[model samples]
Target chain A: MAKREYSYYPGCSSQKGASSSNMMKSVATMCEELDVQLNEIPDWNCCSASIGYGSGGELPRLVMSARNIALSEEHNPDQDIVATCAACWLSTREAAERFEDDENMFKEANEALAEAGMKLTNKTPIRHMAEVLIEDIGYEEIGKGVKKPLEGVKIAGYVGCQTNRPFGIDGESYENPMYLDGLVDALGGDSIPTYEKKVQCCGGALAFSEPEKSQEMIKGIIEAAYDNDADMIATPCPLCQANVEIYQDQINAKYGTKFDMPVVYYSQLISVAYGRNANDAALNGQIIKARKLEEIAAK
Target chain B: MSTNTAMVEKYRNNFLKEVEANVEEGEWVKMCMQCGVCAGSCPLGNAWEHPPQEIFMMIRAGKREDVLTSDSMWMCTSCYNCIVRCPRELPITHIMHGLAHYAKRLGIQPKGNPTQWFSEVFWNNMMKKGRVNELKLGLSMYFKDGFVSGIKESLKNAKLGMNMQKTKRMAPMEFFGGHGVKNPGDLQKIIKKAQELEAARIEEHGK
Candidate 1:
């Protein structure tokens, strides 16, 4: 194997005070354990997440992602760009696809790149980290790498909206993405097999603007996890993890339900399983403390 | 002929024409068959004043006022649930977002749409620094309604803020700095170029 390497785009969410930095840290540890070299894409700008879509027009948003793609091609042309943030993955993939579909948009994006002395073919394969694990690091390899199996923890694999639609992992169903469940099983943990809200949207940044409505969506997702007997919820998207994890108390207060499921990045669980310490996986940032995780990892 | 022409003018087909031109994949909005799957699949579908399916209907009926004024455009989290489920493969998410930007540009956004305010605040933060400074963005958004609202919002989220701080993901010094990406000059240059290109395209299309 030509030692797996990737141009990582941690996205803006990975910055300080943001919930997704834990995810970024968790992914860094998981990558090390999996023998993956994550080379951060130098000067990678925002993927111009949905808020970008909501506020700006197509060309600006496309150019924002294009700059990152162009930078990746300039520096790491051979390696595919892997994004831990689902919105980043979706935004970059959508931009690449849009460029392919519209020559005019491509020309405009390139015009923006040219200002920075760069241009892109939109050829860089933008992939999610989860895709790297599921497709490249097979479940058996993942199982073999696990030092602690996380035997009793029951996780509801929440895929959220961006990863599995219009452009999901190759051949995965839009409505029901099974990659996360398989990942949980590989970790030797119990998965909520019939997790109904697996593909539900976590209201993304709406948790900022339309807090009530976003809370309703969050309520449904968390309640579903609890209803299915999940010890915690695991996800690939930082927005999903953050929204579900940080908002539980508010959701409980509003909905009159007692929900305490710890929402975590899948990488956190994998890192723990692979014998890394809590700090490496950035467990400190997790709002809902997972005593189960702490106990298991301590073993 | 006079009466019929007057009726056509009132229900301006130009409304649909304008949206189609403004939206990226707006032409596809014409393909919506009222399947209602979009409305059914949306996570915040209940919140939409007129859900995705009806927005399409409103577009066709030339109900320009209703379509632009609806909170549905502002409420789209871009979940893509509707796009994947649309029988015609309509990019419902994009259309909703397009309408939102269009609504803002036209100065017709619904009065009470906090989403509109928040997105603009978030967007402006990115535009200024070339990346989002979470604290700055939050401060801007909270203060957007006014100073009092800003304090209230901060107090409300104080616990969450404290938790983030304790984890060391965000530090007190971040209020002074430590959030933006390096080399903001380069980021701004790219943005300027993109805007110029976009402006030229609009001029070419004579829109």
Candidate 2:
């Protein structure tokens, strides 16, 4: 098989020791096995995440992403720009889409870009890492690389907000995206097909600002997972994985329920199923350990 | 004249028209059929004093101060739930943020809104080096109230912090100076120019 290479944008949360650093690690390992080469966009800036809209405002937010795309276009021209972070993908793609639809904004964005000796031609495609995995590399190809099939593990595929609504994986319903479940099944795990809260919001950046309200929303997500009798939850977005997994203890305390559900990234699960150890799968970083996946990795 | 009052005078009591003229994606606010799907679809709908639908109605009703000064828009998580679920296909998430931004621009946003506060902090931190220093961002959040409460917040999350370090998920080195763009000065210049351009555009739109 020919190697596939794309410019990679690892958002702030995935930086070392950051909130979702483990995701970066596991995704790197998974991509290696899948023969996808990710070339990091050199000296990239923030995409001015969803939380940034209030302070960053409209044009500044667009310009911030425009700079990164400008850099990517100059450095890795013609290659599609892929972001592992849902926010990065959404923000950058939104900028490009807006620029395409609005000519004046494009001209102004380019004017700003010229301040830094750059210009946004806006030619490259901005995509999420999941889109690359599902579309670029088919499930059959992904399944072929799984050395240790997760036979008995039942996964509630959580397709949290950004990656689902507005712009989701192609052909998947907004009410219930099945790509996560499809990936799980491909890896030989039993995906709960009727997981109703699959497209629920995990509170995103508000998890910090409004903890109680965010936790209330998160509580519903975890409760739905437990109700479906899933062993673990697998998700595509880093915020979803972090928000859902890190807050379980607090939720249990607040709600007076025993909620110890393990939330792992789809990449980590893929890495583990590809015969990588816990370290390779970045499983140790999980707040609530996926003991079942750990055991599988150990084997 | 204060921008808020000036805007009120300029619009001549039509708050919805003011929003349409100023806020990002605010034009879509008038398209809301009041189906209440946005209100029902919001994850924090119950917590919202005025859900998206009510907020739209308030704008149409010309409740200027109530709509701008209210904390409702700040409660948005930008989950895009309302956007996807809206029958009118309003970019509800952007509108929520736009309302918050517009309120802040007019100097009428609710005081001490945590989301607004953090957004500012995150933007400043990112602008410094063109990439967020996560460790510093975390510390800033923990210490936002004061040193004593910061210490308390640190201790409360000590276990989580230690777990992060043990798992090699966080780097203490990031506190001194983490990774950044090679030419942050260039990025800053671009941002400054962009801000100036946006201001000029808004001024033109106001007329």
- Clashes (N, CA, C under 3 Å) per candidate: 0, 2
Span of 10 residues, lowest total lDDT, candidate 2 chain B: B198-207
Candidate 1 TM-score versus the reference: 0.94
Instruction: Give per-residue CA lDDT, model 1, range A82-200, as digits (tens).
Output: 99888889989999999999998898888788887878877888898878998988889999998999898999999988877768887689888888999999999998868999998
Model 1's interface RMSD: 1.7
Considering summed lDDT, which 10 consecutive residues are worst modelled in model 1 chain A? A15-24
Regions more than 4 Å wrong, model 1: B1-12, B203-207
True contacts kept of each: 0.69, 0.80
What DockQ do the predictions score, one after another? Answer: 0.61, 0.78
Model 1 residue B48 lDDT?
A: 79
**What TM-score describes the B chain of model 1?**
0.86
**After superposing candidate 2, which stretches have Cα over 4 Å from the reference?**
none
lDDT of 1: 0.81
Tens digits of per-residue lDDT, candidate 2, A143-168, equal 99889999999999999989887798
For candidate 2, give the DockQ.
0.78
